[model samples]
Target: MEAPVYTALAERWQDQAGLARLAERAERRLREHPHGDLTRWRDALSRLPPVEPSADLDRPDPRLGATAPDLQGLGETLMDLHPWRKGPLVLGGIRIDTEWRSDWKWERVTPYIDLGGARVLDIGCGNGYFGLRMLGAGAELVVGVDPTLLFVMQYLVCRHFGGDLPNYVLPLGIEDLPEGLGGWDAVFSMGVLYHRRNPMRHLRRLRRLLKTGGTLVLETLVLPISRPGDLLVPDGRYARMRNVWAIPGTDRLLGWVNEAGFENARLVDMRPTTTSEQRSTPWMTFESLEQALEPGDGSRTIEGLPAPVRAVIVATA
Candidate 1:
């Protein structure tokens, strides 16, 4: 076996279920969608507004069976150590253990990607794990943009770990994004779209970043159908940590994305990373495990939703 892709982070995470936006079953449904007449959703992709990606989806990993990431690199517990892709990918900066990669970060978003020779952009690239993963898979140029100083610091940390070595670059904000850059093969606005100051407008930028056929992947929380909600105003603390707004449901959210300049986009996956009510804590990040609610490290907390409670989409421009 070529080792797991995100195993390192999986091991270090003290919290097994702090986040709930992305889940595994979504991957299952995505891969098997064709065989099961899930074509309604599958066909929706072609109907989405055509935007050609200036880049390309990273190549699929030979290790993981489907679209899932084999993140076995995240171990070794050195917050500073970067995970590098071995033979298939020549990435070596920060090493990521499966513990870290298996978290909601990789779970929800890693499945629908093909990053070789594509111009990739990671909004709110946090510690830069996902972007690094894209680069390892073969994205020619992976640009990670974030508003925080920690973004730079974490890039350093990832670099210290060789996480920054692959074809990757970290910039400040979208405004800082290099101009004349044609567009992206794909854009992963993952944990940030819901938290934006003006989500619709921000989404337009994401769409604009892609050519007519590019994929725009999004992941966020959703409200139950019974409880229709327009927004999910997080407690002040959560807002302060992320510094943006959040919605309670996926319908309104997806509706807005379509309104911004998309068509036929559909909800493809919904998984519950955790069901904790502690949205007000910093630990609420994908890295937290308040959901497990157990002492000691590596315990897991799970939610009992028949379908994934979180929602993900591969909307097109």
Candidate 2:
């Protein structure tokens, strides 16, 4: 069956000429690249009983629930798609304890952006959790882009419960977006820059996607140095994450953002990740922050690299 989420998305963006091709391309991609467990996920999605879409974005638990009596069944269906990473969502009576305390990230970021009636994009958005929060914060539209099919499925499940809001997660990446597609009021690139082989190129792409004087909220893993040019290029992996390419210092990160033509680039928040913020839970039954760290020291990763410290920077494009 065709996903209802796409239908809602098409209707929402039908009036915007700039988004026509994007919407079409997204639809084609969704149709062409069905995940191996797409049918199973879809079936699981269908089993979820209808509920009112009421999101509490300010709370630690972003909830969508009703007084439904079949919450046990709903939880079971949600469990079918496991390894939930970016949420602590409360649906019905079930609280999905995810791997990452994404709410903490949200708390760090929400204060910096003026989301009221803004058009926003979240790069590497996992499961559209933050996208939903954007909508809850009064954003006119929130379009999240991620290449992972599993995350897309999880987003669709959230969309099903959220009742056709103006939020969509396209199964694409920053590279998949057309160049010079500028119009968004704010562009967010959280937990994405370090993974890119060329972080400057990623920043430039992000700048290209925003309008004149638009804001860019960038959050990424960084080295703990206080200098401007220092950077750590991991030998193989950082904290068991294989794709991590470069961990730049805050000053170096600001330099890259400024070089990318972003103005007023400044670091807003910087802090190391903690076990309380990211640990294995029942919903995500795999190695987590606790397991990824060194056995004797919490400050370093298992690979003996400097432990994960993330920084959030805001700039004008």
Per-residue alpha-carbon lDDT of model 2 for 21-122, expressed as tens digits? 666677778778857887887788778787776555556777765645787787788889887999888766678899999989999998988899898988
Q: For model 1, what is the error of residue 46's alpha carbon versus the real structure, in angstroms, after optimal superposition?
A: 49
**Residue 181 deviation, candidate 2, in Å?**
2.2
| RMSD of model 2 against the true structure | 2.0
TM-score of each: 0.56, 0.94
What value of lDDT does candidate 1 attain over all alpha carbons?
0.48
Summed over model 1, clashes come to 70
Residue 131 local lDDT, model 1:
65
| Segments in model 2 whose C-alpha atoms lie over 4 Å from true places | 8-16, 52-58, 226-229
Q: After superposition, how far is residue 211 of candidate 2 from its true place, in Å?
A: 0.7
Instruction: Tell me how many clashing residue pairs each candidate has.
Output: 70, 0
